[model samples]
Target: MRVLHLAPYPPARDGIGAYARVLAAALADRGHETAVVAARPHPSSPPEVLGALGDPGLPEKIARFRPDLVHVQFAVPAFGLRVPAVLRLLRELDAPVVATLHEITRDTALLRAPGRLLYRRLASRCAALIVHTRDARAAAGSAELIPHFCAPPPPSTTTSDALRARFSLGSAPVVLAFGFIHVDKGLDVLADALRHVDDAMLVVAGAVRARDPLFKPMELRDRRHEREVRAALTRHGLAHRVVFTGHVPEAEVAAWFATAAVAVLPYRKAAQSGVAHLALASRTPLVATAVGGLPDLFSASGSATEPREAGEPSRGLLAPPGDAAELAKAIRTVLDGGGHPLQGLAPGPEEVAARTEALYERVLAGAV
Candidate 1:
């Protein structure tokens, strides 16, 4: 099968980009010929509202690739106007299109009204939609939940001792918050939660691209968020407990996960998270917000718990969104082993690669 996998690819290392790159590689390994139509981020590429308008030569690039099936890894915010235009081109080509919706927010999320409208338009045109979690399915009109996969664990280059030494970290428990930095990811709340944790260090390993003028940075929202988070840490006198490693390479990330005692995805919203899935693949226990696709993703682990009988509380410590106090309590409980450990998160890259290959085959067969 010839497949053209589209989304934010390299040079823009966001989660959706990572997902597209990895998924395309996996599909290629499964015997399908895959070509990727990746767009560069603004300032780095061009500042056109639609990402591809900056790239005048993309259509010729797609025509040359001539894929049998086109899979679009669509994120409302990142693709900008390029997303809809890509869909329109695919429609003209009459290729079977599969759009994987990476997020779903009614309002006040990253994309705002225009983003949602664009996403809705793109989704409506696709032949099939792929969702990462059940929570995503609920948010998307009618999408299939094809569980997201992770990269294969890298060979152990450095032991825990070596990792600790490299980062100047002590023997204190390390809780990893890995992946791209964003306002909705609940980092500020996590920062506040750190005050309640004793002898535990939060290693935030991700890039801070949320509000940069180059790539749709939420100046007001993210700036205010960063300020409040710093203020909270200072108020609690816990400034020294956090290490912010802004966007390290992939090789370095594996070492952080291997050394950390656990991982966290305390998101304010839930569509689906590749971070949570990656943590599970890394064999690291996780404590995440009980919203969106997280509940379904971790439901297999017995880790997802509803604190209240329906409306009383969330199944997984269900804290109110943006509530620093509740988030702090949840992190403390998880570190202390009071929360669920999720012992069954050991899926390997081989398994993920196989499943992804099967999905590509299914899409190709149906489309052709």
Candidate 2:
């Protein structure tokens, strides 16, 4: 089968783009021909990236590619949180589309009634809407649940001692918090939690989403929150406890996960997290908030816990979103547990790709 990935592919600096790159590579390895139509023009993108969104002649280019299916790595953040642009892509695409809704519960999380209507409109045009968790499938009303893809963890190149020395980290457990630097990610909550943990060091493995000359409202909000976090940390004399390694490369990202005693996702609001999947790939022990589809990951069913989120008490791996005290406790618990990595990584990348291919077959046959 031939497939075309429609997303912010690499050189574009989005996780879903990185996702598309990996999925396309896996599909190609599975003997399928694959290509990409990036979300924007990135001059340095690889050859398989044939065109970009908003190119007047992109439709012609996709027509020439003649893909059997088009997979859209749909996320509001990737579109700079613009609904109209997302709608335009859904309405205008001229091939069978299977959209991976990277975020679904955001509308519900914020109680934004209009966003729900927009989601419905987007779903109506697709052959199938794919979500990574059953919580998302439930919230989406109509969607297919696919396991998130995780490539095997790479071997750690540098020892923990070397990593600590390189980063000027003192003798303390490292708690990692990564992905886009944004307020909703609860960096403020994380900073406050650090006050309680007392001994661990935080390695913030990212920078703000992107640079904007005019400074859009969203950009301003993120920057303001980051400043507040920094100020609070300084006031508490915890400035030396945190290190911000802004926007690192893939190798460095691996290194951080390798050295981290625990990975914390203290999102105040979220749809799901790609970072969680990365931690799973790294087999890093995690402490995450109960929000969006995160609960589905802990549930053996990967299904709904519904009206209330599920918690992994057996593993002590979950905390209430935005609760600094609970987050601090969870981090301490992981550290006390000797940093034994979390177990289980079923349905790795190849399995996920095969499942995706099966979904494509269903869509092409009008069975989805």
Candidate 3:
């Protein structure tokens, strides 16, 4: 099968870009001819650029590529608000089309009404629609629920000792929060939560790129948000206890996970989190807010609870969204080995690729 993948390719600085890289490679490994049409070509990406998704010439490129199927990794911001134009182009393509909707933010109907209408139109045109969480299914309408896929962590010679030494971190338990810095990630909440804990250091990894063409104009980097996070830590006298390792290389991401006593996802809101999947791949214990698809990921039954037993690693802990005190307690539990570790939650890259290929076949045959 010849497949044309549409998404941001690395080093485009989008998590969906990283996902495309993995999926494209997996398809190639399975003897399918896979090509990527990235939003923009980054120097690090292995595929050819077909310009941004919103470009008028995209239909011409699709005609030239002549793929058997077109697979789009969809995020509303990645394509912007110009859905009608993009939808028209997709309809022009000769090949069957499939789209994986990355998020559908629940409960903001007033703000998202227009986009939702456009999205429904887009979904109606596709052969199949895919979503990562059950929560997103209603918005996607008739969508198949496929869990978010993650590649296994790479083996690293860099050990916890080396990582701690490099960061000059002492024996204190480290709570890690990584990924592109954004206000929605709730960095300020994490900072406040850290104040109530004792003998622990916080590491904020990743950087905020100056411009993200994948995002809408209004969603560009907010330096003011970064300043607010720093000010909060300084005001609470946690300046020395937190380390900001801005924009580390991709190779070091797993090492940061391995070095941490626990990985924290203090998101204010999310449809699902790729960072949370990365933590699971690293086999690192996680503490996350019970918002969106997070609770589903951890098999969380209900509200926060004390870890059932010690030394018996399980699938991490969950706190209610936006509760600093509850988040603090969850972090403390994990650091003390009272919380479960995340393992075997998501499928490996190969399994995901195989399932996806089957879906592609089904969609092409109109059997879905």
lDDT of 3 by residue, 1-368 (tens): 98988776777677887888788888889999877777654556664556566666766776777799988887755555444446776777778889888866632332488668767777777899888888788767678888888665556757778889988899998999988787677888899999888789999997775454534343444566778889989998999999999986777777888888888999888888888988877667899998788887664443343333344344478887778999999999888777654544577678888989999999888898
Off by over 4 Å in 1: 41-54, 106-113, 153-159, 210-220, 299-330, 341-343, 346-368
lDDT of 1 at 116: 62
* Structural similarity to truth (TM-score) of each candidate: 0.80, 0.88, 0.88
Write the residue-wise lDDT of candidate 2 on 132-241 in tens digits: 87777888888878878766445556676777997899778899998999888999999999999988899998988874343376677898888999999999999999
Give lDDT per model, in order.
0.66, 0.78, 0.77
Q: Native-vs-model 3 lDDT?
A: 0.77
Question: What does each candidate score in C-alpha RMSD?
Answer: 6.3, 4.8, 3.8
- In angstroms, give how far residue 343 of model 3 lies from its true place: 6.1
Clash pairs (backbone) in predicted model 3: 314-340, 314-341, 316-340
Candidate 2 global CA lDDT score: 0.78
lDDT of 2 at 191: 94
| Candidate 2 pairs with clashing backbones | none
Q: Model 1 Cα displacement at 365 (Å)?
A: 6.0
Model 1 TM-score (2 dp): 0.80
Worst 10 residues of 2 by lDDT: 305-314
Off by over 4 Å in 2: 81-93, 107-111, 152-162, 211-215, 299-316, 338-343
